[model samples]
Target: MEFKRTNMCGELRSQDIGKSVVLMGWVGKKRNLGSLVFIDLRDKTGITQIVVREEDKDNYKKAREISQEYVIEVKGSVRERESKNSEIPTGDIEIVADKINILDSANTPPIYIKDDDDVSENLKLKYRYLDMRKPSVQKNLKLRSDIIRTAREYMYEHGFTEVETPFLTKPTPEGARDYVVPSRINEGKFYALPQSPQLLKQILMIGSLDRYFQVVKCFRDEDLRANRQPEFTQLDLEMSFANQDDVIEMNEGLIKELFDKYTDYDLELPIARMDYKEAMDSYGSDKPDLRYGYKIQNVSEIFKDSDFKVFSDNTLEGRSVRAINFKNLADKYSRKQLDKLTDFVKDYGLKGLSYIKYQEEIQSSIKKFLTDDILEKLKEALNLEDNDLVLIGADKDKTVLEGMGALRRKVAKDNDLYEKEYALCWVVNFPMFEYSEEEGRYVSQHHPFTMPNEEDIDLLLTEPGKVRTQAYDIVINGDEMGGGSVRINNSDLQEKVFEALNLTEEDIKNKFGFFIEALKYGTPPHAGLAYGLDRLIMLFAKTENIKDVIAFPKTQSATCPLSEAPSPIDDRALNELSIKLDKE
Candidate 1:
């Protein structure tokens, strides 16, 4: 190039007309019209139009050969465009080229660098570099960077010290499966990746750091989903001498700042709060989407004496019967569509779904089994209207809630029932432990280190099922953006929690001996929260798939199409680590 760059392709404007400028970027698009060649020069900021007249013979020849994604440099004078484009910021001006230099040539990209390109996700992952060149993808990445920077600034201003924790540590039981790495020096021993810096952050509080935070990577060898990845980032923080209110207040300020600075929407301070039990009973989900109303209502008592076996038997057996009224959607769903809904609930382990269509007449598949009085009572209980459809689930508590919860979201999405741009709520007072059928024992609902509700301490051994904890989750639009709890600063209380979880002395010593020992060193009354950075970015980016917010993300199968990781290792490498793969 003859000249050093003076401005980005997207930086030129009408005010810069008559000023000489040098711009460097990739050829976004090119068109030749015999006498003039027009090129859309693109950099990270955006794209700008550059024109080369045939009168400038040498530059015109070079512009004619320019293709999409070709790296180039141009020295030109900015001029007001003859046709102003209201779409782009740089549309009011054009760069008249006095010089053009192609830095590199390129073959055609496998995927188009456009937001609406309808290509397979696999293809996008395979050519992610090209995919990232799209303005939309770049915008998402840029926003992610801005959010992280804002988070760091907020934490620092709040007297929180940024800290780094180990990526490799001793393997511990509970939570999700860990991605383990064999220690070459230790032979058969392996080190597990940190699921979260839960233990380390608590120890920092004990170490008297007072306040600590980290924007770090964590790994979990778990099944993939739309909002899940094998490895992801988290904004983890812990504060000593902080209670539940303190933690919530600090995070609320940070969230408010982020939204106000980056988004057009303003978040109301001190977001709404809901009890965990109320959330589940009303919305059938711990992380309930509050943007729209389709609240699940418990109708078990109303149906206790009903003739319908599905309803009566479950109610009589201490199970549940829940109903959701999809207002004025009776005609929207036909018999075939209702049957499809039944199949959807079946996927959640419900035997089937029962519904009542209230159109000109009250009609239901189970109407024959119900008496007129029972039907009338049900209609009143659900507040059914002339054109409303009520879907019902009857089963064990968990099954019923799961089925109805899924149906609520699905129906809302299918019918375009979203009423708000964002709904943020805090779900508090979660159960400390839940029965794990596979383990035939109780496991921590949040984690073993969580402090139980003080009043429920006696119930830990007496009525373990009734014990609640000081845990809280921040749910936004049906997704759990983050969750945390007051830690068990008392070693004795922590031991009792482990006992309730049925962790034997030996199990406790092996898995959490270090953490328990650390607590003995006068751990402060501390609480912290860790936000799923990817999930938070997803919400801000308005993207359904988590990968859209991530620069290089794995596919649903947990494999990187671009790098093709998780491939077979050489035998010699395994031998160095004293490891061998089990061949079936």
Candidate 2:
């Protein structure tokens, strides 16, 4: 390119007419229209039209030869387009080229450089550099940046100091498996990537950083889903002298501000709060999508007296009876289709699914076992109408909720019952500890640092099943966008919590000794939340895949196609760390 680029592809307008300007970008589209050669130049901002006329014979010939995505710089005079293209931002303006210089040429991209391009995910990921050229991809990145900026600004306004915690730290055993970094200096001592800055942030609070915030990176070597990534960013925050309500209110302001700035939809303030039990009972999901009307109803009372063995057998003790009426779905599903759904919930440990169809007359396989009064009562409890399908899950309390939860989401999605407009809610009062049969012990549902509700402390020891913690999750449209809890400030409560989780004194000392020591040094009652910024951005961008919002994201197997990570380290490098590969 002979001349320096002066204007962005999207910045030129009629007001700049006749002004000499230089523009550089990839060729969006090129065509030879009679005597004039037209080229659409595209950059991250947008696209602009450039015209090389026969009057400028040299430039016209040069422009006619360039293909899409060819890098070029053009020196021209900005002019009002003779034929306006109303579709683009710079449609009314055009550049009449006097000089054209091709900087680089390109082969055709594997994926289309448009938002609505239909290409396999593998191809898109393989050529991510080219795929990110689309205007939508650029906008997603910008939107993500804006959200992070707004969060930082909000935290600063509320007297929060941004802090950076160590990425390579000692591994804590409670959470997901960590990606370990071998240490050369300290042989046999490995540094594990921080799953979260949970401990360090608390230590920061104790160190008298009253309000601390960090837009930080966190790593978890875990199984991936559409929303999960190996390496993800989080808006990690913590505050001293702040309770659960204080943390919630501060974040609510940040959320509202982000939505108000980035979207046209107004966020409902003081978003609806549901206790964990309520969320489980009514919506069958912790992160409930409250857009539609498919609430899970407890039908135990209706079937308690019924002769149906399925319902009666499951309700012996630690079991539940739950049903979801997908209103008017009898015609939408068949026996085979229902069978597929049964298999879907089975992944979540559900034994089987029992369903009844309500048409002009009552119809069900189990109807024969029920008397007329019992059938009427069942219909009344489920609020059944003609063509309604009442899907039932009778199992242990956990499996019933899990099965119905999965079914509720599946039905809502298939029926197009979801509202695109966001619905935000806080799912609160989570169980402090959940019994982990595999581990043969109770484990902290949130984290060991979480404070139990004051009144529930007694039950934490005796009736552990009934205890609730001061934990809350910011659930947006069936996704857990973020979650946190008030920390146990008192030493006694913290000790009891650790004991309940079956962590011995030695185990606690080894794992969280520093944290326990910090709590004794006048630690203020604090609470914090970490937002999965990538997931949050994905939701706001109306994308279901987290990879779409993330630049150069890894695959479901946590492999980066672009970089091909988890590659074999050189023998010399491994030898320095005193490690050797022993493959089977």
Candidate 3:
């Protein structure tokens, strides 16, 4: 209390021996070793050992009372430790105290402050403050800040203007459900949080802002997952008078900057590009993980004339059979394991799985149905080698792709076939519209603003499903980190695209009327991308759980355990908002 801290706990080394220092931090751990009391003092930087000798009776007594996470201040002289720790940066030195002060007392933490703690995720989110004390968690938070800072610097250097858009905006009919906020002032009106700054950013381009970027918060009331959140951050950017390649090159430079600064791996210029169809056909994903070699092969030709009903039936009418040769893993899987894999793909909506195993003998689930000629043809087509295990699935075109695509990734992961490195690429030329059974109409695959490819323009009306947009997604190791597309500069083209989406006059007028108005006013050819900031941080932080990179994240149910949000509001507040609870 009497002196301000002069040094961080982690900054001290053996060179600072005998240097009197004032250190203040939380007591990470306290140990009473009979003759000496040792405390591990922690701050955001790191941790340092604090020792109070029995001879320093007053300080020793004070140190004895310090428990884990108790706030403390130590006026100590840097001294060599009797034992040196190799694991920590400040491990080689110790702080021998002249005084030990308990700045603040603490209650026991509900969760352990260690990274390897086997606590439930709900409990961890509930006590996120305590969870953040873990060195790994703190490192993630710090890395997140550093990433944003670097992004701003790179964008500024590249002549991109950072802008902020409104959080409370109109609800769009397309995309994810909006998290709506009722307006108290307006009788029954509501404001939906921005899903992305998609429309406004284009309007910025229309307003002649050459290039714009925003490190903004966007919300969607979507189902939660390990890699998704209801509220997430995006590095949104747009460029006026830019084509697909122009936007790609500019963003590629930004990505190179971030990767070059943060990661050790050298990122080669001009990330590889792939078409939507190629990615789907070869890897079963739009964002394919190219680090490993289990590329999917279409075996429909060989299976078409076979007696196997599953394959023969699927190979008809534009549907086809697909297989992935998980090389040299034939012997690794038991019959039970293969059955489990079948169940796994079923979750992706496939009826079942068929597999051909080449362990010691050539065997398959449909081996009985295979003629010698057909078997030989299948082997030749797939280029099957010794010890190759071929996973086969068949269904409708879309179902087969989704199921087999998931299977490919699952197999690769289970076998450790992929490296944990960034394999970045641009998945380009996506479909302009995809059919939505729930809506019973076509919906914009990206958004209605996306410009269809010039070559595909005529197909917009007659063969709407065949139209490809100039959209592209930056995929890293099979994760869609960010994506955007060339905008529909012409108002007529935008209307046609909406019509293809089956949006009636009322739907268009209600949802995108203002955005439609903006398109009429000299909008330029533009393309942009919004990187999922949480996913980006995950790659940098080496964390798969989206919650790890976030300071306070909600559970899978989209509830914040720490603050108990979405709880019952008082009747008075509800009445002010002109809302009433529907208690059934």
Candidate 4:
């Protein structure tokens, strides 16, 4: 009998044994014995077994001809499996086939449609359509979609209107390079793809779109890393008449809901809060992963009067000394391995890294140079134990924090100290400005539009580095999941910010004159945050590679192998835009 699919392949079980059903999917596998044939029908929902008996002559013969990936519709009745395959979710039931219809025939796929297939990324990308047939990839995409849906619903419930900002806008100098689009109408001019809807969202507050949010596409022309892509999606949001605390509370509810609904883990709301200075001093990272406990310890005071010149010199320069006490990892890493770790911190501009491994006899690099009193004090200060490995970095305060911060993570990973779970930390109290020695000026750490902490306004020009901003970042497992700041609303305060950044009158007029004009017409006190949606999905799906989350991700070189984008355009089209190609 011919039949339309009444149920998905995996939806049936032993309870539906006598119920007639039709199942349709690609043939995941096929096996033929002397007189009988068995096939596994696979779909996004799951897999089910189909059996054809020799007595059904024509149907049994047709099943013999079926191969992997052949799309077929099977009319059958569910039955208990003779041999239960406990590995799969629906392994207890089998579908006894009565008839089969081949819907579509497929060539043998270049890559296997199974997880743990050892195919090259290039091959997988080239045959991405076939590759996505794998259950693992499908599951990841579904999880990502669900996460976005939950986020949207949560925002709507909390009074946010989804609004889309423009894709093309003016290029600002501070952020990463922009992906520019050529203009035929304005021949020599170009429009830039937004790095984020930074300026536009702020302008919306002036326009009274009070609470706005968008799950939007953002672009940046930058080198890619394992978890970064040139074109990415962001959960962009802005709110009027809200302070840092207000934004934080709303986001906490959304995030806690996300974790509770999506995974088996229960994420604690009102998650632990860490300040910028505390995070840097303790972890050397703004986004500290709290799953592990190897917090950095300051040893500058204990090492100040030491005979070791490196420690003493660092202190004299107004820099600092710090260490991560890898409690039991001293036995795990050998001497040669420790030297390699020393070489690693040099990349972060630290002059050197020193370590002391406490054993039956305390082992160290500068052991001979240390007096008993100094050595004892150093050990006491660090709370060192017999099996602890102490890794130290010293230089400028910033360099010490940055270098050791990274070393702590490296050691944790090497020793398997990570919890393999989520820990969200809201890092706040970020300094509003950072001094640039090259430019001989101060630059906004977040952006110029970010308001400075009210009490610090007097020091904007005189002590720019000391001024903190009302900015916050939602960090999860060591990655900044989202960040934003309470924006500058008062026109006079905005000008004062520009002045502190060493922007001349001409510089201000050229880049952000229009934004200042918008502020004059009554802007509301507003704030918002944007989450790296792709990165958030990566976290929720527990995927290390960003490409796994994106459907048609570009390679590190920013070229799309599947569609062959960024290829040479037609000569006529290039000429129409009056473009020229330069060759070396």
* Candidates in order: C-alpha RMSD to true structure: 1.2, 1.7, 1.4, 1.7
Model 2 — which ten-residue stretch has the worst lDDT?
361-370
- TM per candidate comes to 0.98, 0.96, 0.98, 0.97
Model 4 alpha-carbon drift over 4 Å, by segment:
1-3
Angstrom error of the Cα, residue 285, model 3: value is 1.4
Provide the lDDT at 33 for model 3: 81
The local lDDT score (0 to 100) that residue 471 gets in candidate 4 is 95
Q: What is the C-alpha lDDT of each candidate?
A: 0.92, 0.87, 0.88, 0.88
Scored by lDDT, model 4 comes in at 0.88
lDDT of 1 by residue, 1-584 (tens): 76899998778788899999999999989988899899999999999999999999899888878888999999989999999999999999999999999999989988988989999999999999999999999999999999999999999999999999999998885489999999999988999999998988999999999999999999999999999999999999999999999999999999999889978988998998899999988888999999999899998988888788888999999999999999999889989999999999999999989888887877788878667787788778888788998899999988999889999999999999999999999999999888889989888888888888999999998789899989999999999999999998998888888878888888988988898888887888999999999999999999899999999999989999999987999999989998888998
Q: lDDT ranking from best to worst? A: 1, 3, 4, 2
> Per-residue lDDT tens digits of candidate 3, residues 1-584?
97899999889998999899999999989888899888999999999998889988788787777888999999989988778999999888998889888889999888888989999988988888899999998899999999999999988998999889999998875478989999988889999999988888988988999899989999988898899998999999988888999989999998998898889989999899999999998988899888777788888988887787778878876788988888888899989999999999999988899888865677798879878787688678777788889899887778888889899999988888886576888999999888889989888888888889999999988998999989999999889999988888898888888778887899888988888888787877888988998999999888789999988899999999999987998999999999998999
Superposed on all Cα atoms, model 3 deviates from the true structure by an RMSD in Å of 1.4
Model 4, span 135-197: residue lDDT tens = 888898888889999999999999899988888788776467989988888897888899998
Q: Which scores higher on lDDT, 1 or 4? A: 1
Could you tell me which 10 consecutive residues in candidate 4 have the lowest summed lDDT?
1-10
lDDT of 2 by residue, 1-584 (tens): 68877989989888888899999999988888888888999998899998888887778778777998999999888888888988998999998888999999999877788988998887788888998999988999989988888888888989999999998898897479999999999999999899999999988988999899999999998899998999999999998999889989999998899888878988988888999999888887788888787888888877776688778777765577888888888888888998898899899898888878889776665768767786688678877788999888888877788779888998888889876678889999998878888999888888888888889998877887678989999998889999998988889888887778778889988888888888888987788999999998998898998988898898888887777776998899989999988987
